[model samples]
Target: MTTDILTVSCPSKRGIVATISSYLASQGCSISDSSQFDDVETGTFFMRVSFISEEGKPLSEIAEGFTRIGAEWNMNFEFHDSTTRMKVILMVSRFGHCLNDILYRWKIGMLPIDIVGVVSNHFNYQHLVLSHNLPFHHIKVTKDNKAEAEAELMAIIERTQAELIVLARYMQVLSDELCRRMPGRVINIHHSFLPGFKGAKPYHQAHKRGVKLIGATAHYVTAELDEGPIIDQETIAVTHAQSADDYVSIGRDVESRTLARAIHAHIHHRVFVNGDRTIVFPASPDSYAADRVG
Candidate 1:
């Protein structure tokens, strides 16, 4: 069975669903899983549909047939073959928790992505990345060579034709120019205690304040720093009995899981960026199933 995904975003109006359903039926496609949302505030509609080509229609033909419907609705849409894995680039620094977790998932077939390479500002994880038989690029950055370093990073992205960049606990601050160039294509993970716990050692700060909740946030990378549109978040309960080191341990676990979930959503095409916010659809059936339990 050939599984394909269709994502559509356009102004909210009548008959959008009917038109889409009718077109898919005409193309001999059976809708297996579908999710749609109409934002009343913004008058925008988002939909994600997973279908099987019952009549064995080629994707090119099916997509060609949908162009008229797309034009009629003034839609922004894409037809993606679910079997095709998206190419992704992972960036990291000293932190290895999120990096290690993602690598494990990818190795186990949990994350359906083609990791083009791993980029780091330091050599901390060079051996870790290489052990997986993956290419690793060590591009050290400093105050004076930040621009040059980013240029080399861009060169890697272009050469590999990476579709997404995952900053898995990368410590460097990306330049505004890079943010603007990529827009919603970059994702980053960090501790969720923003504003409340600024600067270094956020978990320590939270412990100092006797906070009861520790969490992590995964979001798109933008020029405004950590203020990008959120994609996924998670929290763990803490107690006064726990030490700051305990908080750090719990926080790292949360960060790793949150980042993986966010990346999963992105690679599956379930995330739709709308203005400063996002509308993330639920996963299609069996989309999260790993090839192996390990």
Candidate 2:
């Protein structure tokens, strides 16, 4: 049996589920797990269906068969084979908390992705990434050569055929041009909770404000600074007894957790962009189950 995941987004209407199930059944598929959402406020519908092809139909054939249903319902849909892993490029700067966490999860099969390459403006993590047998690109970026550096980075992305870019605490602000080109393909992890404390040293800002809660946000990269469609967010309670360094320690854990969860949804095709927000469905059964490594 071959498992394939189907994702759909369209205007809200009746019989969407019936149409999808009926179509999949016609393709000799049986739904093993399914999730759907009807956003009344946005007047849109989103769904994720995990099904097994009992007759062993190829992904292309199954997808081709859904065209008519897709057209009739004006739906945006994609069929992904469970065995296919998404190619990704990870970018990071000084902070290695998020990068290290992602590496561990990827190695353990909790996060399923092919990390094709790691790009960094600094050479801090060259040995770390190289130890994992992954290609590491050190393309230093400075104010004087920002454009040239980005060109080099683009070349690496193209050469690697990377489908997604994960900015795991990369401090450099991406130019508007790159953000426009990639649109939904780029994901960034911000230390702050977002729309609250943005920009450099967000932990310090939060500490100064004397807030009781500190959080992190993982969102799609946009031209605006730290303002994008939020995919996942996490917060931790803080007290005046904790120092600024303590806040930093707590923030690091949340940042790693939030970013990992967002990427999990994205790579699994369980996330959809909805205007200024996102619709992230629950993970399929056994998604977080890991294959232990020695």
Candidate 3:
């Protein structure tokens, strides 16, 4: 038996489930697990179906055969081979917490993706990444070398066939061109609650403001820093008694966990961009682990 994962989204209509399940039954496919949602206000239907294809059916064949049904339902969808891992390329500079977290998750099979390479403007983490046998590139960037460095980044992404790019506290500002070209394929982690103390030393700023809570945000990387559609955010309450360093300590954990969750949602195709905001559907841990593409 061949296991396949299918996803669909379209205008809500009566009998969408019946049509889908009956079509699967007619094709001799057995449903293993399924989930669906109907947005009453928007009249949108969304579904994720995991099924086993009878012997002799492969993912490509199943995908090819679903065209008619997809067309009939006016669906926007994808058919994925559940076992294939998504290829990822990570970029970071100075900060190691997010990068370390992702690396550990990947090593432990918690994040089902292949980290193709690590790119850094500094050499701080070269030995740490090399210990895992993954390639690390050090292409220093300055005002004069920005173009050349980005060219190197693009070259690595192309050669590695990287489908998703993560900025794990990568401090450099990306050029306008790369942001447009990559669109929704990039993810970035910000250390503080965005739209507030934005630039550098966010923790210090928040602490100085005497704010009662600290937070982190994980969002898509667009041309504007910290302005992309947010995917996930988490907060940890604080008090005036805590210093900046204390905030930093607590903030690190929030940053890593928030980024991980956002990446998980992105990889699973559970997030949808709605203008400057995002719509993230609820997902269980098992459903979360199996389908994530990021």
Q: Candidates' lDDT values, in order?
A: 0.91, 0.90, 0.85
Highest TM-score scorer: 1
Please report, as a residue range, the 10-residue window in candidate 2 with the lowest summed lDDT.
285-294
Ranking of all predicted structures according to lDDT, beginning with the best and ending with the worst: 1, 2, 3
Candidate 3 lDDT over 1-294, as tens digits, reads: 546777888889999999888877777788877778887877788887778878657677777888998999899889877677789999999989999999988787677788999999999999999999999999899999899999999999999999999999999999989999998889999898846888889999999989998999999989987799999999989998899999999999999999999887777666766558666766644455464455
Candidate 2 lDDT over 1-294, as tens digits, reads 656789999999999999999988988889989999999998999999999889888889989989988999999999888778899999999999999999999988888899999999889999999999999999888899999999999999899999899999999999999999898889999898846677768888888999999998899999997788999999899999998999999999999999999899899887899998898898886344322245
> Per-candidate TM vs. native?
0.97, 0.96, 0.90
Query: Candidate 1, residues 1-294: lDDT per residue as tens digits?
Result: 867889999999999999998899988999988999999999999999988899999998999989988998999999998888899999999889999999999988999799999999999999999999999999989999999999999999999999999999888999999999999899999776455885689999999999999999899999997999999989889999999999999999999999999999998889999999999997778475422354
Give candidate 2 misplaced runs (Cα > 4 Å): 289-294
Clashes of each: 0, 0, 4
* lDDT leader: 1
| Models, CA RMSD each | 1.3, 1.6, 2.9
Displacement of the residue 62 alpha carbon in candidate 3, Å? 1.4
* Residue pairs in clash, model 2: none
Model 3 segments beyond 4 Å from truth?
1-3, 39-43, 54-56, 284-294
- Candidate 3 residue 161 Cα shift, in angstroms, is 0.5
